[model samples]
Target: MSAIAIDQPTYEVGARKWLITITVITCAIMELIDTSIVNVATRQIAGNLGATVEETAWVITAYAISNIIIIPLTGFLGDIFGRKNYFTASVLLFTIASFMCGFSGSIWMLIAWRFVQGIGGGALLATAQTVLVETFPPDELNKANGIFGAGIVMGPTLGPVLGGYLTDNYSWHWIFYVNIPIGIAAAILSWKYIKGTKTEMKGKIDYWGILALVVGIGSLQMVLEEGERKDWFSSLFIVIFSILAIGGICLFILRELKAKNPVVDLRVLRFRNVAVGSALRFAFGLSIYCSIFLYPVFVQGFLGWNATRTGLLILPSAFLTGMLMGVNGALIKKGISPKALLIFGFAMVIAYEYITYMLATPAAGEWDFFWPQLVRGLGFGFIFVPAASLTLAGLKGKDIGQASGLSNMLQLLGGSVGLALINTYVARRIVAHRVDLMGNLSIYNPESNERLQMLTTQLIEQGNSSQQAQQMAMSIMERSLSTQSSIIAYGEGFMMIGVICAVILPLVFMARIKKGEALDVGSAH
Candidate 1:
């Protein structure tokens, strides 16, 4: 037997085992939902709080920053406080913060509460994965991972749908308020059913490691979230954060490696599977989040779709992913290689991105995206199941928690970096495309003169004077030019995701699962 199976606590069985699964998965989904739910309601939130939209963005930014900073430390926290107790406390914290957030009287007040909520929410993710891993037997681990994958896939998809519904029908506050009952139930169930463990402290706490973690990861997340808005390195704010991110991260690595009691065990990456799997997860996160960010903007901003409708466009794919999670789990149980599954998944993702790139015209409708979205769903289903199972496959007792934390942290960071890069790239492309279009729109160009004349004649025919017609024609031309530039830029952005996925696909070869590794089936199916 592997050291993990030998040293780990007894796996939960019977009804209690199932109960624990439900509890942890529920908590995880609740946390994931909060991450994206507020996005759809941001406009209403800004209006109600009397804050500018830019200022209201801080509400999301604060949550993300705290969330990333705390994610990597969850394993340590779970170890120090015991998983069950830490998880229960986190649930309570998240619940209470959600309540406070709903009742906040001002924008900054809401932002503060959201950050606290994120601290609580961050624990729910990595720790919940560990809880589920420990809850199931070795032979069923793949099943456990698949079940969790479904929740992970569905959570972000459901966020905007639920947010749009609650915000449109009621108010923005209800988005936060909605978490109250769910959090309460998750907390109660977790405390009741989840197993607990306690370990004696071996040495002084690594206070320096903790500080480095906060400074490094916090500054890095801040840079990702705010860099594009601040115009990247050109802004003093981004530059300062950039320097701190590098310095703090370097210090963090050195401290963790040499500390007697490290805040995060960086030594786990020495395992090949953990190292390669974490890198692949980073790419996976980048592709998924960038696609999510891009498609909505394209449809809503350029194609004039409503938030609810755009969200619905993503729903069918989410459903498909939920179903495929089970099938992928079964495949893994049958001795299918996780690396192969990962490669196939990325292939599907690349194909989806290519399809979307071709379909990104201004005239695209809901029906036009059906196949590509389904492909994306297939890709996610393949990726998420194997990712968790493969990354921590051979890890020993405490190492499982440490590796899980590291892997999840990298995944989130990947999404952050991808979004920042995509935002900058698309913006630059738009400006360049617009300049090119403007150059061809000169009065000396025959096509430009002919088009302007046609537009002016149409306005004149509609009873406008020649002067008014000419002015309106110019305005229409400028608007069209801008729209065209945006369309071309966004199309290229979709292709960019495919290119990135293609680059990442080859990394799967480096992640080799042993011929007959033993793992328990998870409750995902």
Candidate 2:
């Protein structure tokens, strides 16, 4: 690769830095919060809209697919229009969509509004990261990443908590309604405070790349989101979408590589560290998103804990994650080997998963989960900023924007793909576990006979009827089998995720990553 000019522009830093930071972080967090905030409120939304549970799920899927489609193209969009103009417009689009989402009359209407919302929200994330990086000096990029990473990790974690609260106290619409004020403020702030300096490109739009990504990513996202729901390939919808996803992606890759001006710069992956960083990013997405998806639902749904209680249980770990991000940032700035931080992060995450597998029993309580969750927060804090710093370190200024866009998109896509796989794995595990448990409970087994007799007799003593008691005994035994199977399935998930993490750990060392040490070490030392 030929050396390119690093045309980094600059401005004075003071209140401007603080203002831009708050503005972008708020916008980024708002976009992220929307990703998960509506998850818990799906049931209420279904009932209110007179839609089935299956149909209401489209509300979530619509936002996610659109978000994924737009994320990678954001860099090109910013190049076409100025970043500030594009950023401000996206915020306004998001704010308006939030209002429309709240007032939506039907489930389809809500889904449509949410799709628009996702398009806007997607730009906010990729652009916000670029803006954050530009706002700080090169040496302090890790610190900026630290602050941004805190929001990235915290947003999804807090989403369910906020959604549960809004749905419980107010109504489901309030979840969407809540975004309007925040979005409006973020939009105005982005317009006024966030400066733009990129030169606009003079060329035709990459329409082919855009269409290919939209179809490819959109279909892939759909297949991931709806595959299990539609019984994978058994449903014609899954088969068609799977084909489109594969074909579209292949076309997108070809189109981008050959295009004079690609919508996405896939060539950025050619950088040694970018490839390794992307892998780590994928792992981070898979583990973090899966943990958020499963743990709370397992606690609240299976253990009979309420939503608020579950949210509180997970909060301490998230808080620690946020604080440690700042610490890790400072460490990276002080010449800490990000490889060491990354390895530590991988180990901590695996340990957390192991603890989770061991403790995911029928009897686990809030306290039992406390330590494991805290460890997870530490793992994430260690992983995010360092990996991000490693990824973009070698890129020229021109490549950095597209590189950031692609990396962020991959991470989100990884989470979606991971969630689908986990759901399938857990479902299959439940069935396998149930089959194994049933083998021991067969009528021919001596212990099984004794237990069944004891249950029937005990029920007869209370109910005064042999026939009724026998039926009740059978029903109770079946319930126990289902419950035990579910617990075992959940427990197995931790190990599965841990093994995946272990598999990816060696890649960190293999990458020829440059250390964060440099001349402008500053006060961080």
Computed on alpha carbons, the lDDT of every model, listed in order, comes to: 0.86, 0.86
TM-score per prediction, in order, is 0.96, 0.95
lDDT of 2 by residue, 1-525 (tens): 112222445733999898889998888888999999999999999999999989999999999999999998787777667678999999999999999999999999999999999999998888888888777877678778888998899889889999999999999999888989888888888888876655635566789989999999999999999988888999999999999999999999999998877878788888888889989999999988998988987898789998799999889989898898888889877878788999999899999999999999889988899999999988988999878877876666567776778789989988998899999999999999999998877789998789999999999989659999988988899898899899889888877888888999999986665564342211110
Candidate 2 matches the true fold with a TM-score of 0.95
Superpose all Cα atoms of candidate 2 onto the true structure and report the RMSD in Å to 1 decimal.
3.2
In model 1, which regions exceed 4 Å deviation? 1-8, 519-525
lDDT of 1 at 498: 90
Error of 2 at 95 (Å): 1.3
Q: Could you give candidate 1's per-residue lDDT for residues 302-339 as a string of tens digits?
A: 99987789888899999899888889889988889988
Q: Residue 295: error of model 2 in Å?
A: 0.5
RMSD, one per candidate, in order: 3.0, 3.2
